[model samples]
Target: MTSPLDSRQILRRQLRQARKNLSNHAQLIAAQTLVARVDHYLSGQQTDKLKKVALYLANDGEISPHLLCEYFWQQSIATYLPVIQGKQLGFARYTADSMWQENSYGIKEPVTADYAPSRDLDLVFLPLVGFDSQGGRLGMGGGFYDRTFANKRPDASPQLIGLAHECQQVKSLPVESWDVPLQAIITPQQSILVS
Candidate 1:
C-alpha cells in the first residue's frame, strides 16, 4: 500500500495532468459552473454588511473570477486584489477596468499607486491549485498568500475562502506550519464551510 505522503504526491501529479488536459471550452464551462454556485451563495447573503473583500484573478487552471467580479461590482461592494511585492502582498481595490500590468510571473496586478491595503477586510477569496475537505490549500508553490495572512492582526482576521474546481479536491493534503487554513472552500460542486 502506498503511504499517505506517496499518495499525496501521486494525487498531486494526477491532478496536474488532468488540469493540463482540459480544453479551453471545458475550462470555461467549469469556471462558469463554479461562478454560478458562488453567485447563488452571494445572492442569498447580504452584501451591504460585507465592507471589504479580497479576490484573486484566475490563472493557471483555477476557476475564472470574471463573473464573480461582475456580481460584486454590481452590488457596489469594495473588491480588492493581491499585489505581490517581494515575499509580501498588499491588497488593492480593483475595478472591472482597473489598469494592470504584468508582474514578473506574468500575473496581472494593479499599479502601486492604486493600492489600498485593508486590515479590516470582511472576506478574502483565494485561488487554490488543490484543497481538501478540511480546507487545506495548495497554492502555486508561492507563499505570498500565506505570508499576507500571517501579517493580519489577530483581532482583524478576514474570512478566507478558497476557490477551485471540484476536480481540485483531494482526500488530504500536506501543509506546512506557516500555512494558514481557509474558513471555507468554494468549488463547482459545493461550498465547504471549514469553520
Candidate 2:
C-alpha cells in the first residue's frame, strides 16, 4: 500500500497534468465556480460582517478573481492586494479604478502611494499552487505569503483563505513550521473551512 506522502506525490503530478490539460474555457468555468463558492461563504453569517477583504490578481493557470473583485468593490467593501517587498508582501488597498504597476514578477500591484500601513483587514484571499484538506498550502516555491503571515501579531492575524481550483487539491502537502495554515480553502467543488 502506498503511504500518504507517496499518494500525495502521485496526486500532485496528476494535478499538474490536469492543470496543463485545462482549456481556456474550462478554466474560466472553473474560476466562476470557485468564485460562486467563495461568494456563498462570504454571504454566510460568519463572514457577512467582514468589510475589508484582500484578493489576488490571477495569472497563468490560476483561477481569475477579477469578477470577484468587481463585485466586492461594487458592494463598497474595502479591497486590498499584496505588494511584494523583498521576500515579504505588504497589503495595499485596491479598487477597480486603482492605478497598478507591474511588479518584478509581472503581477499587477497597487501603486506604492496607495499603501496604508494602518489599515486592518478582515480577510485575505490567498493564491495557492496546491492545497490539501488539512489547510496545508503549496505556494509558488516562494515563501513570501508564509513569511508575511508569520510576521503578523497573534492578535492581528487576519482570516487567511486560499483560492484554488478543485484540481489543485491534493491528499496532503509538505509543510514547514513557519507555514501558516489557511482558515478556509475555496475550490470549484466546495469550500473547506478549517478551525
The lDDT of each candidate is 0.78, 0.77
TM-scores of all predicted structures: 0.85, 0.84
Off by over 4 Å in 2: 1-17, 46-48, 116-119, 153-157
> Candidate 1 residues 1-195, lDDT tens each?
998557656776777666767788977887778768877767666756977788888776667777777777787877889888888888888876688889888999986465656566778888887889887878776788888788665346587888887788888787778887787899878998776
Clash list (residue pairs), candidate 1: none
Q: Give candidate 1's error at residue 112 in angstroms.
A: 4.9
lDDT of 2 at 96: 57
Q: How does candidate 2 fare on TM-score?
A: 0.84
Q: Ten consecutive residues with minimal summed lDDT in candidate 1?
A: 111-120
Q: Give the root-mean-square deviation of each candidate in angstroms.
A: 2.9, 3.6
Q: Estimate the lDDT of model 2.
A: 0.77
Best by TM-score: 1
> Of the candidates shown, which would achieve the greatest lDDT relative to the real structure?
1
